[model samples]
Target chain A: MIAFRNVTHGYGDGPLLSDVSLTLPPGSFHFLTGPSGAGKSTFLKLCYRELMPIAGTVEIFGQDVSHMSRDAVAMARRKIGVVHQDCQFLDHLPLADNVALPLTVAGREANPEELKELLAWVGLSGHARARPPSLSGGERQRAALARAVITAPEMVLADEPTGNLDWDMSQRLLTLLVELNRMGKTILIATHDMNLIRTAKSQVAARVLRIRDRTVQHAGADL
Target chain B: MKAPLPRKFRLFGRDTRTDRVVPPSGAAAWLTLLTAAAMAFLAVFALALSVATGRLADRWSEALANGATVRISAPADQMATQTQRVLDILSVTPGVETARALDPAETQALLSPWFGPDLPVASLPIPQLIDIQETPQGFDAEGLRLRLSAEVPGATLDDHQRWRRPLVAAADRMRMLGLISLALIGAAMAAMVTLAAMAALSANGQVIRTLRLIGARDGYVARAFVRRFTTRTLTGAAAGTAVAMTAIALMPSAGDAGGFLTDIAFQGAEWLWPLTIPPLAAIVAFVATRTAALRSLRTVL
Candidate 1:
C-alpha cells in the first residue's frame, strides 16, 4: 500500500506533481495515465522511496519515506516490485537469472521448478537461457513482469509495462497483471494505453488516475 | 530447468549467483591486478633491502662490538717501551678479556692493503697497534683513556665506537628507509586500487541501478565488485611474489661483488618473510575495494 499526502515533486524547473494526496489501500488495482514526462514515473519512484517528495509526505507500507534508512528502503522495495518501460537488466546475465534476481538479492533461495513455471507463465520459457541483449522488446517486458512478481511482492508498481509491445502483447501482459490482481496482489500501472485500461477494466475492477495540471485526479466514468 | 554455467563463468566466484550480477571484465579489473602485481614486485625488493640492512647492522655489531685498538705513536726510540706500558695497563683493566700487541709482521700485513707489501715498516713512523678484546661487560673507555694518558701519553684507546656507531647507524637508517619505501608502496597500491574500484563502479552504473531497482542492498552490490577485485589482486600478487622470490634466491652471495652488497638476501628462516607479501597484498586490495565500493554505493543509491 502507498500513501502520498500533499506530495510535490519536480526536477528543479517547476512543480510536476503539486499538493497531490492519495492513499492506495491494500490489494487495489489502479492505473496512472498522463502524457509524456508528466511525472508518472516520479510518482512510482516516490512510492518505492527512490525519490523524496519536495513537499509533504510519501509513505510505503505505512512507513514515511523520508524517515526510512537506505536498508529500510531496500526492505520496503523487496515487498514492492517495480517494472520499468525500458526493462533494464544485467544484460550479461541469462533471462532466468534476471527474472530470479529479486529473489536472489532478497537472499531467498528461488526454487528451480517455480522459477521455470514463472518463466513459462510469462511466455519466456524458451528464452530462459538467452541474455537480455538478445531478447526482443516484448520478451523483455514479459521478462520484467516475471522478475517483478518472482519474489511475490505484495504491491507491484509498473511504469508503462507494455510501452513497446504490440497490441496483442500488451493485452497479454495486461492479462498477466490481471491474474496477479486476482491473486490479491496490489497493482498500479502507469500507461497512456486506454485500450489496455479498458481491457483491464472488463477483466477486473480497476480505477484510473490521471496526472494533469501538476496533480493526480480520479478520471472515473470518463475513460 | 536450470542449465550449467560456462567454464569461464565460474571465474571470480561467478559460480555463486549472487556474485554474477556484475559483469566481470573491465579496465578496473586489470588495473587492480596489474597494480597489485607491480607494487608487490617492488615491495619484495624493498623487503629484501630492509632485511638485508638489518642483517648488515647485526653482523657489523657482532663483529665490532667487543673489540678495541691501541696505537702507540711515540718516537722510534721509545716505541717499544710505550707499547709495553700500554699492554701492562690494559692487562689489569677490568673487562679487558685479552690485550696483545700485534707483531711487526702482523702490522705490516694490516697496512699492506693500503701501502704495498714492499714498504719498509720498521723504518717508517707507522704506529704500533695493540689488539684489545673485551668481556661481555666491557671496560669503560673514559676510565681506560684516563689511565692510558697518565701512564703512556703516546698510547690512545680506540674502542671502535667512533666508527662503529656511524656504520651501524647508517645500516639502521637504510633499513628504516627500506621500510618507509615499503609503506609508500602499499599506500600507492591502495590508492591505485581505490581509483580502479571507483572506475569500475562508474562503468557499471547501469548494472548497479538495475540491481538496486530489483531490491538489492548496497552490500550485495558492493560484494560483487569487492570479491572480483580482491581475487584478481590475490592472484596477481601471488605471481609477482613468486617471480621476485626466485630472483632474490638467484642473487649473488655476500662475498661476491667484492662484498659491497653485504648479504642482501634472505637467510635460513628469512625466506618465509617474502611469502607473506601475497597475502598482505590481498588484504590491502580487499580493504581498498570494499571501502571504495561502499562509499561509492552510498552516492549512487
Candidate 2:
C-alpha cells in the first residue's frame, strides 16, 4: 500500500506534482494519466523511495519512505516491484538472468523449472540465453514485466511499461498485470495511452488518476 | 549452448551470486592488477632492505660489543710500561676475555691503509695500543675508563661508542627508511585500487541502476566489485612477489663480506615475509574498492 500526503516534487524549474495526497489500497489496480513530462515517472519514483518529495511525506506499507535507511528502502523495494518505461536491463546478462534479477537480488534461488515457465509465459523462452541489447523493444517490455512479478511482490508500480510494445503485446502484458491483481498484487501503472486504460477497465475494475495543473485529480469518465 | 552458471554458490557467503553482478571491465580490472603487482614488487624489495639492514645493524652492534681498544700516549721511554700496565689492568677485569699489546708491525698494518708504510711506526711517537676482547656481558666501560685514566695517566679506553653509535644509527635509519617505503607502497596500492574502482563504478553506473531497480541493496551491489577487485589484487600481488623474489634470488649474493647493496635479500625464514604481500594487498583492495563502491552507489543510486 502507498500513501502520499501533500507531496510536492519538481526538477528545480517549478512544482510538477504539487499538494498531492492519494492512497493506493491493497490489491487495487489504478492508472496514472498525464501528458509528456507531466511527472508520471516522478510519482512512481516517490512511491518506491527512489526520490524523496520536496515537501510532505510518501509512505509505503505504513512506513514513511523519507525516513527509511538505504537498506530499509531496499527491503521495502523487494515488496514493491517497479517497471520503468525505458525498461533498463543489464545488457551483459542473458535474458533469463535479467528476468530472474528480482529474485536474485532478493538473495533467493530461482527454481530452474519455474524460471523456464516464467520465460515461456512472457513468450521469451527462446531468448533465454540472449542478452538484453539483442532483444527487440517488445521482447524487452515483456521481459521487464516478467522481472517485476518474479519476486511475487505485494505491489507492482509500472511507469509506461508497454510504451514499446505493440497492440497485441500490450494487451497480453495488460492481461498479465490484471491476473496479478486478481491474485491480490496491487498494480499502479502510469501511461498516456487511453486505449490501454479503457481496455484494462473492461477486463478489471480500475480507477484512473490524472496529473494536471501540478496535482493529481480523480479523472472524469472522458475516455 | 553453454551450461548456465549455478545460481546457488555460498562460497563467500550466501551472496556469492552477487559477486559477478558487475560486468567484466577489462581495462579497469587490468589496471587494478598491474597497480597491485607493481606496488607489491616494490614492497618486496622494501621488506628485503629492512631485513638486511636489521641484520647489518645487529652484526655491527655485536662486533662493537665484543671488543675495546686501549691506547697509551706516554713518552717513548715510558710507552712499554704504560702498555704493560694497561694489559695487566684488562687481565684482572671481570668481563675481559683476552688482552694483549699490539706489536709494532701489527700496529703499523692498521695505519698503512690511511697513512701508508712511509710513516714508519717504530721511529714515530705513535701511541702504543692494546686490543681487549670482552665477555658477552662485557666489563663496565665507564668504570674501566676511570681506572685507566687514574692508574695510567696517559692511557685511554676506547669502548668504540663513537664508532658504534654512528654505524648502528645509520643502519637503523636505513631499516626505518625501508619500513617507511613499505608503508608508502601500501598507500600507493590503495590509491591505485581506489581510482580503478571509481572508474569501474562510473562505467558501470547503468549496471548499478539496473541492479538497484531490481531491488539489490548497496551492500549487495558493492560486494560484487569488492570481491572482483580484491581477488585481482591478490593474484597480481602474488605474481609480483614471486617474480621479485626470484629476481632477488638470481642477483649476485656476496654474503656478509659482500657490499650491503649487493647482499639485499631475505635470509632464512625471512623469505616467508614477502608471502604476506599478496594478502595484505588483497586487504587494501578490499577496503579501497568497498569504500569507493559504497560512495559511488550513494551518489548514483
Q: What tens digits encode model 1's per-residue C-alpha lDDT throughout B1-301?
A: 9986643223354337766888877666776777888888899999999999998898888779989999889999999999988888888899999999999899889889899898789888989999999999999999999989998998888888878999999999999999999999989988888888888889888999888878888878887877787788888888888889888888866575546375777889999998899888878887888899888878755
Report the CAPRI category for model 1: medium
Off by over 4 Å in 1: B1-15, B254-257, B260-262
A202 Cα displacement, candidate 2 (Å)? 2.0
- TM-scores for chain B, in order? 0.91, 0.88
Q: Mind giving the per-residue lDDT tens digits that candidate 2 earns over B68-117?
A: 99988999999878888888888899999999888989988999989998
Write model 1 residue lDDT over A160-213, tens digit each, in one string: 888878887788788878887888889999998888998899999899999989
Q: Which runs of model 2 end up more than 4 angstroms from their true locations?
A: B1-16, B74-77, B115-126
Candidate 2, residue B2: how far the Cα is off, in Å: 35
Top-scoring candidate (lDDT): 2
Share of reference contacts found in each model: 0.72, 0.70
Instruction: Kindly list the interface RMSD, in angstroms, of each predicted candidate in the order they appear.
Output: 1.0, 1.3
